[model samples]
Target chain A: MNPPNIIFIVFDTLRRDICSIYGGDVKTPNIEEFLKDSNIFPRAVSSSPWTVPSHMSFFTGLYAREHGVHEDLEHGDGRVLDKIYEYNGDNIISYLKQKGYLTIGYSTNPWLSPGTGFDRNFSSFTFFSSEYMNLEEMNAVNEYKRYGKNRYEAAKNLILSGNFQEFLKYYRIHKRIIKRKREVGYPFIKGSDLIFDHIMNSSYEEPFFIFINLMESHEPSALWELDIDDRKIKYLDLSGREIISEKKMERTRNGYKRSLEILDFQFGRLIKYLKKMKLYDNTMIIVTSDHGQALKEKRKIPYYGHGNFLYDEIIEVPLIIKFNNNVKINIKNWNQSLVNIPEQIKNSIEGSMDDYMTSEYVFSESFGPVHDFETLIKEGILPSDINFSLMNEKMFYPKKAVYWKNYKLVLNGLTGELDEFTENGKSQDPNEKKEIVENLKEQIYIFKGQESFRV
Target chain B: MTQEIRIEGGLSLNAKVAIAKIVINDAIDRFKRPFVVWSAGKDSMVVLHLVRNVAEERHMDMLPALFIDHGQHYEETIEMLDKISKEWNFKVIYARNEDALSAVKGNKIYLKDLNKENQEEAKKIAQPGEILKDENGEYFEYSLETSVGNHILKTIAMNNAIKRYRIDALFTGIRWDENPARSWEVFISPRENPPHVRVHPILPFTERNIWEYTFKNNLPIHPLYYQGYRSIDGKYDSKKTSDKPAWEQDLEHTKERAGRSQDKEGMMEKLRRFGYM
Candidate 1:
């Protein structure tokens, strides 16, 4: 048989427990239906707590420490393309492209845009900004950037070039987008309607690789075209600068549920379209997340975002894969790391199913706050008086979590302290399993190439 | 400190600078807590300058410089460090092994008087009979030539700083063209004992490239490099190679680190394995 077409879908910032299939209250009907023939990995761990590193791990099959494309105190987002370019010839995209696959990419996340080197070997890559999905807004953003973010300069240049009509058109679209946002939170982000419409309109050859990153379940909750603006939920609720009222949080949670409902509807539509096109059975669809988000759940500290901590609510993501061929494949209920996504794809291409998503040891790493929070404070985006000392102590440390069997250990590299040692997700004394702890610690050292100093 | 061959010689200085900036930017992005291992030497100065450029572009303050204060550095070196760091607005954190420094008596360091931690480290890296005796019992010469001395004074100090500061990445100035041991190293290398990654941003640069970058960027030059010494280390172990200035000397055929004789006869590989740069 020929190689099957691959469709890797990333549900950005999606938590496993929130899904209905994972025994949560949120209704993900489409995903539950997809799970009938697919393998659902309930214990899959992301390699990093944020976007760039975790996605790089998926593409390179290496941890953040090994790949070295993560965030630090000095850098949060830009200039990462230079580092990503180093893996151009060795990444999964290039590998599959070399194997005669028509590689295409669609990322709604700004970090995975073409400017960031995420489109290295793709035949065509398109970045659909959540706010700039309309052609007019995209043209306006491009023009603003062309003039170095100077609106007046962009207008002057456009008018000078005899493109005054185009300038007016861009202005009208920009105003419409902003007005829509002000009137009803965010528009068209949750359903991914634009992306799905694009996909339905485009035709593809056989044995192709399509990578899609949807930001529906991400932030703003898209507020359901609700008048309630959940945009400040990220800055105010996440940073704990202003505690969200219980009623407001309940409304936010409901908005999130509605967002999921919208996403599920879109997903169902995609599935139906694929089957209508007679392509559902021939496509290998893999759905996973780079990392999960924290909604201010009970914890040692008030955590609200994904990148600062390695809590289960942030690192544990869903890994569901529907392979093309139907075979009685044994699903090992072992820990799986997102770093093995590349190997799983390769195995699928080679017609292998055994041990495809199984691993004895899974690891996840975090390097402090992925965003430049200090700069935010300096720029008054965050309150300067808010004390970051305690938060920094908790969030700024380099942490690594190792999952072996039913035990998990999260070690803090800064203090050489065990931030967490649990069995089956409950706190446990590490001394009772000293051997396992030592072995896992040695595994970390070896993975970091520091085994020579393991005592 | 000595280089035998110039293997990666074809890249233009601009290309080398671009690659080094990429490496530096990646390290700044990947590691939570990072420091530049600045020794106030030419190669390290280039590394510091490159890191500063990236940090400035990113609107980040310069990473603190970890100066391995072995208590044997040149006065001019210290003066240059003080002046330049003040002018450039970066912190210089001295990584000194206080236990070993305080135990020094004239030219000999009493090994028995060191703390138990320092003694254990010295015992692990020291060769048999290398620890001699003076009027005090079981002492080693306060010299950087011995593997044991270098380990106790510099490596131990640096490692302690790493543990103390919880440094996850250290930007060092080791180049591929510097020595055979470092020739195999990549842009980012992980180290043990204290467990941190070494970010070698200038690994592809040769001695000539270092000078060219220094001159083109107008980086601060060590006074001794102008006085015919190609490589400057602790004043006790360094010497002048020729009467001519460093750049005027025969760079292609002559040894770049001829003045620094600590890395002699396969000693650098051993020192490097024991956490010496």
Candidate 2:
């Protein structure tokens, strides 16, 4: 029997609701077409809403609690591996390699780079140059001055310069401030093409396991082409005043949609290429995103975006897997988290068709100092300068509903209150809030009670 | 009767001047064939400035800078190194443990691998005068390759082309206060197998002294330090603040503890779980 070739594609900041297969208005014809033949998990959720931890969970098959690589570490104890239980007694790449598979990974997110330990399980991994982003790079000393003078100015200068090298310098100066935006405009498909070509033409005699990450929807959404008809219109409200000019909004949304379409198109082409090469039949292709994006939609918080909160829009993502002809299981009703992926892969490999369910409740946390109320104020996310001394203080609030067999419970982190919202002019009552608080508190206590996974 | 003189402050003007003169003299003495270890960090920047100053003062030929690229350094570090190299017109050479880094890149090696490999190799590469075997035929040697003959040979081969052309002495800017391990390093030491001598011109200096000197001398340091980072260890910290005490904000000690030998097994376990091992 031929070893399965695996293809893992991650779309950065891609919201599940926007995809056509996920019941959105987005014109993802290629994706919709592909999903028809593939196994799509409509209720797939992410371990974390943010990129780093989410990707960690996906690859390691452990919740953030088990791994402990929660936020960026300036000088991490470098003991990240000790916290992880050898899901299969080895990493995914090592396991696959032992099975005679050639591993390759390409990501536009720098966090996925080897510096952050994400490159560990892959034979080859490449990250988009952070130099392309218009941000000040933080040096060791500047990292000392977390929120220093001219921080934004330095970042803006780098952006304005448009020179990759200069941008790298600025990026070092203000890494904390510009990390997200710097991740926004990566050319995902183009970068992956380089790896794909190498894999196709290389003389290496091994089945391939390829991973690709696309960063189009991250931030400063800059992928739309101005020529599309859907993006060319201009609009005005009933007052004849422009809430958002039709042409501009169309241009922005169209650009983002066009990029998604391009991703889908490329994915289809890659699959076809693999099929033509006779590698598709044995390949188990899985499509997933680290996390979903916030498209300026109203959530518990009146605003739309990831970070500071883990709402459905941020935590829920699209997961699709196509496993040649061995199995025909449609896991439509099964809600799973990214952490369940590795075990699922193992079970699938062993030909286990039993109803394998993910844990009922998964947890995540972010401890970066930038999440303080002051930074939010600077970013204009909050109403005023709120005392953020309580930001570091962990507060747990239970979710309104635990989806997928009551196994999965959502707990609100630091910004839980800000995300509280009213639906149709009616706010949730004290009882609803109390239930959420209780569930969240229980999860927190459970996390605290567990022996520190520190080796 | 002669009046006894009393200095108004902790250090007298003469004492300060004498100390400055001694520092300048030591810098000049070391600059003759200085091989500056340029990490593009704060201390290295000061070292480079001191070397340049010494060269200018004595009208001696400047030495080339040496950079050991671990391949995972921040982009800013590379850029600053390039800029400083070009601005100062100093020859720059970057040496990398490609095998180790590639192993790291391929997930075959990790931070623990470094310590493990170093420990194993340490037992095999004993110094010339040191006892390498016991009477019962048990073999023993130095605990680190940093002082090994083969490592010295490799370093010479890797660095000789540039160092032979210019350097006679390797000038390192390591300060005693950076880490407990560095506290015992002497001001000067002879190379194990090479002809060149190792000099720590800034051995007596504290972190504050280095900062004061760099500030007074207007040296170009890697800008990350100004942002809030206190160490050269490649890690990310998002909450560093300039106004706060470094110890209060910096995670260097915590991070260092993660890599210590006392926690070796634990660190290895963490590395394994993260798939780094």
Question: Which candidate achieves the best lDDT against the true structure?
Answer: 1
Deviation of model 2 at B270, angstroms: 33
lDDT of 1 at A144: 62
Q: What are the DockQ scores of the candidates, in order?
A: 0.02, 0.01
What's the TM-score of chain A alone for every prediction? Answer: 0.85, 0.67
lDDT of each: 0.79, 0.52
Error of 2 at B272 (Å): 28
What tens digits encode model 2's per-residue C-alpha lDDT throughout B1-277?
1122121235443354345446546644543334677778776777677767666666654556777564546788999888988888766767554444443423123223344444344344434443243433323221111233223223323343332222445666766544444455555655432344556666555555666676677777666666655555333212344544333444322432232222222322222122110
Q: Best-fitting candidate, measured by DockQ?
A: 1
Report the TM-score for the A-chain of model 1: 0.85
Candidate 2 local Cα displacement, residue A427, angstroms: 8.4
Model 1: runs farther than 4 Å from truth? A86-89, A133-175, A182-188, A222-240, A450-455, B1-277
C-alpha DockQ for predicted model 2: 0.01
